[model samples]
Target: MPQVNLLPLPLIASTRAASNAIPGRRLRRFPGLYRWLLPAALLALWQAATSQHWIAAQVLPSPYEVWLTLDYLATSGDLWLNTAASVQRVVAGFAIGSLIGLVLGGAMGLSPTLRAYLQPSFNALVQIPVLGWFPFALLIFGIGEPLKYALIAHAALVPVTLGTMQAFRQAPQPLIEVARVNGFGRRQIISAVVLPAAVPVLFSAFRLAFTKAWLSLVVVELIASSEGLGYLIVYGRQLFQLDLVMASVVVVGAIGWLIDRGFTLAEGRLLRHRLTPGARP
Candidate 1:
């Protein structure tokens, strides 16, 4: 035969069409561009409900009213003060908990005997919700800043411990063996092989721990605090100022979202080497 083509003409045409379908495919490639769609729709619905009197104004303030209340809080300086206090507690707790978790998890991962001895107790303890520890924490810490620190620390510790241990356990055996074969010492192997491989998991663990710590701080503030974002929410509800309550809620969510985005950016910067070429950060 002078020429032969195995593929069908329709299949080749369809493949070319898919390759050239930029306008139709751009949305799928960059879905993040559409994230605001749902929020915008919800806001429109909320405004409509408020204008139509479908929901009582007293029960659910308009978004504009909530914005006004947020402005007042900001200008009066209560918002910054509460936010700073919460951030302080989260920082202190997360630092202490992450240190302890790293040490414990490293020990367990390195020693089978240690893991066997501690795993059961750790598992049992983690099953109890952070709120369940509140009474004991209150009794021990006396409803002070220490109480918030302790609860946030507890919330942070579990995820970090689990993540570290799993990272160690799942580290590739071949790489570790190669390190040893190349005359690497224990420290060298850990620094060059183990830690590098575990970076992604460790970052994820830190993110989870940070979230847990923040949430625990809010709960503790709500239950027993003189000041913090959580206290603002409680105070607003107590005064039946739905606008204040909504404002505080909005601020809390926005802060959490910003913090998460910050972490994601940091992760992308620190772990860019692990990402494939041309991938989105």
Candidate 2:
């Protein structure tokens, strides 16, 4: 047999060219940040417009005023306390809702009979606007923590269930056959093949569910409950405190941003191997 060369000249040249073409290794790895630059510019423009009173400061409190409000709230420990309470409630409700979504989704995904049985009702329920559930949730759970959980669960269930079921149904047939040829049992096939294959799609579902839970928390608070970021907005409205309302809006937007950031981190960690450039989330 002829001896083979371990290092091919062309391969070496290609690797060097790729490395040199990239701006930097770190920058290449984080192209996601580049897209956020536009949003950052928009924020600066908005801050300038508001701060200079280009618009009525009453209608749009300057970012500085909001920051000052935040600082005051922070010094009094009021911001932390209220934020902590809201966080706990939203997190708890989201966890339970996500769990339920995963279970029900798995059940339908794996079973044609179950899917047939549940599909119509599931589709119907999902079509109802989530905010419309507030009155019913209140009637059922009565202005308590249960209402929060119920409403969030309602918001989270659809995207997760649909994404999971659709992902599994669309799993590559060849991959399933490979698992079968290896003599894997149903559970083994699901654990080894289906879950890994479905994960990237499920990550998208998770992102949707988290957003739903966040918004649902606010809605429930505004309508029924006594506390949370939503309540902060409602309280401001009732008192005609536009600055408070504007401040709370900024806080809500900030919380949403942090939550999305957490998801991006989690996706990078969880789907490290499968994530590819330019793939749909």
Candidate 3:
């Protein structure tokens, strides 16, 4: 039997037209424009708020004032010095923590007995807030670089370990089977099959670990450092310079955003060939 149209011609045309327009209407297709809209709106609102005096200047300085303060800090090299210190600390801590996490997580993931033994204590220990470790760390490290590094490393370790464990455990079974069919040894199977499959998740873990390390850098500096963005914030507060504080905050946020964006771009490039056309991994 011949199939008949279920709708009128105009209705069909309209539906087709709407479907055709859908691609053009998708906001994510223009991600840069979409992403900037909110920030632009917020900036405008901030300008309005300050100009209209809706908020007191003492509490929240004008954006212009913050910009001026940021300019002054940059000119004086204070911003760069503090930012470099923070970055160095974050890099050192993240490297140490992530390396340890990968080793420990890999061992535990490969050996169920090891995981069973460590999982409970590991989970319990991670439950304590980063700040909760402060007293002990302070007593042991004495408000120095070691304390900052230890705390930052502690912050970075948990996520990377969990992510690495999950990544190893979740490697595609089909690939593992294929490797086994070829009589690949355990090490070869892991290196050739599991490692490639786990790259995406591992990258995510590293990104998260870096974020934690960066945040912990600020926290540690806030508690006991002479120089860093967090210390800059403290200095501004002590001097009652809201503009300076705001500038420091903006710099911190901007730097974190830039670094995270770099990671995201690198991940995209690294995994580009793995994804099918029009499909996300």
In candidate 3, which residue ranges exceed 4 Å CA deviation? 1-30, 276-281
- Each model's C-alpha lDDT? 0.90, 0.82, 0.90
Decide which is better by lDDT, 1 or 2.
Answer: 1
What's model 3's overall lDDT? 0.90
The estimated TM-scores of all candidates read 0.87, 0.79, 0.88
lDDT of 1 by residue, 91-170 (tens): 99999999989888877877789999999999999999989999998899997889899999999999999999988877
RMSD of each: 6.4, 9.9, 5.9
lDDT score at residue 170, model 2, on the 0-100 scale: 74
lDDT of 2 by residue, 106-220 (tens): 8888999999999889988788887788777778888778888888877877788888888788778798899899899999888888888889789989899889888888877
lDDT per residue as tens, model 3, 47-82? 999999999989889999998999999999999999
Separate clash counts for every candidate: 0, 0, 0
